[model samples]
Target: MPRPASDKRERLTEAAITLARAHGLEATTLAAIATEAGVAQGSVYYYFKTKADVAQAVADGVAESLASARSTLGPEPTDALVGFLGAYVDDAAAICAHGSLLATASAGTGSDRAHREAIDWLAERFGDLGFAAEAARARAVHLLAGIEGGAALAHALNDLSPLEREATHLGRWVANASA
Candidate 1:
């Protein structure tokens, strides 16, 4: 039987993400990614020129996921920010592993610009919520770091309390900080 086209590329990207998450970016190899995706190693090359390309795609996917989550936020900007923070805080475990992969890969691949682009999107959204531009940018960076740290703590301690607790504080901070 013949196979479809897009599935291979999608699978390779997904496999790259999963491998990079389970194993650090340095350890995730093209062969490993291909094995994880259940495809020939050569096929990954057909879609992505290098492992870094896959990493970039993973980073892009993470950013897209955050934006997609934010799309469900209500009309109010403050509410939207709160919802965005909550989305991460509430799912810290998964978010941690997933975000770590993107973070690790972004650094390894020198895709800092891509990471910054995502952060910029976030800052712009906050700016729309009435925060001063610089303040919005700073706050966005702070929240992203905070949530990632919160997620790491949640994972290391095998406890969700820190994340759940941080979510409330984050929501309040965004509200007050923007005001």
Candidate 2:
């Protein structure tokens, strides 16, 4: 029996993200991604038309997690924001490490805007916690910058402590902003 299309697409995007992170986007090729994904080279085109398209899917995957995180939070906005903070902190290594590659490709449809879309999603959630619209957006951007900055540093130094600390601080900041 044939595997599901969604599963194949998911695998391809994930492979792309992982490869992009490890090898750098410029070094990661469609052929390489197909090999990494364990799909035939031609099969890759069935799901994604270009590397940017696959990159965009990767972004959407990240954003989907944010949406899922938001849904899991209870009715209280402040607590939810804190939950998001913790989640981000936990995922800091991945996010920070992939920061450069992902950001550089922020031009495609779907997942290309995933990073900004994720931020926007978080900002909206922040608003739910009683912050003014602008303030909520500012807080979201602030958290993003700090976490990604830490990620970038961690990526450079081969360490995760910076990302962890930034994630923690941002969580606190989000809590305080909501209070």
Candidate 3:
């Protein structure tokens, strides 16, 4: 019996994300994803027309997970912001250490739209925290850059302490900004 389309697509997506996270986006081939997913190589094309599509799906998945995690913090604006930033930093750092997949995704073709949408989502989250529009935009950008920077630095140095410290500081900053 054939697997459900949604299940197959999800498996393919998970495989792609795992591959990208282990070997970087450039190494995330449809064949490899299919193999990891335990499906025929051609099956990947049925769900994702191109490698870019797979990458975009992965990015969207990460964004969705982050959004869900953020939602669990309740409706308190400051708490939500702090929790979101902390979760984002931890998630990004983990992904980066996996193979810097997020960085590779950001550099890939057709990634601009996904990146912009992710930023917009974050900005809206900040805006919901009662920040002025410009301030929310700035905070979103700052938080993202700080997380990315911290992750890269930690990776380069083979250290997790710096990333943890930076994430904590950023969380405090978000809380203060929201206050």
Question: Which candidate number maximizes TM-score?
Answer: 1
Candidate 1: list runs displaced more than 4 Å. 1-5
lDDT of 3 by residue, 100-177 (tens): 565566555445444455467667878987777888888788877776677777777877766777779988887677
Q: Runs in model 2 with CA error above 4 Å?
A: 1-6, 107-112
**What TM-score against the true fold does each predicted structure earn?**
0.79, 0.78, 0.79
Residue 157 alpha-carbon offset, candidate 2, angstroms: 1.7
Who is ahead in lDDT, 1 or 2? 1
lDDT of 1 by residue, 1-179 (tens): 88765688777777877776666667888898889999988887888887678778777766666667767877777777788778876666567675566667677576665457657866877888777989889888887777667776776687877777777888788778634
lDDT winner among the candidates? 1
**By TM-score: ranked, best first:** 1, 3, 2
| Cand. 2 TM to true fold | 0.78
Model 3 pairs in collision: none
Query: lDDT scores for all predictions?
Result: 0.74, 0.73, 0.70
Candidate 2: pairs in clash: 56-111, 56-112, 96-151
lDDT of 1 at 84: 74
* Clash tally, candidates in order: 0, 3, 0
Over 26-87, each residue of candidate 2 has an lDDT whose tens digit, in order, gives 67788998999999999888888877777677667655655676688777767776776666
Instruction: Evaluate model 1: give its TM-score.
Output: 0.79
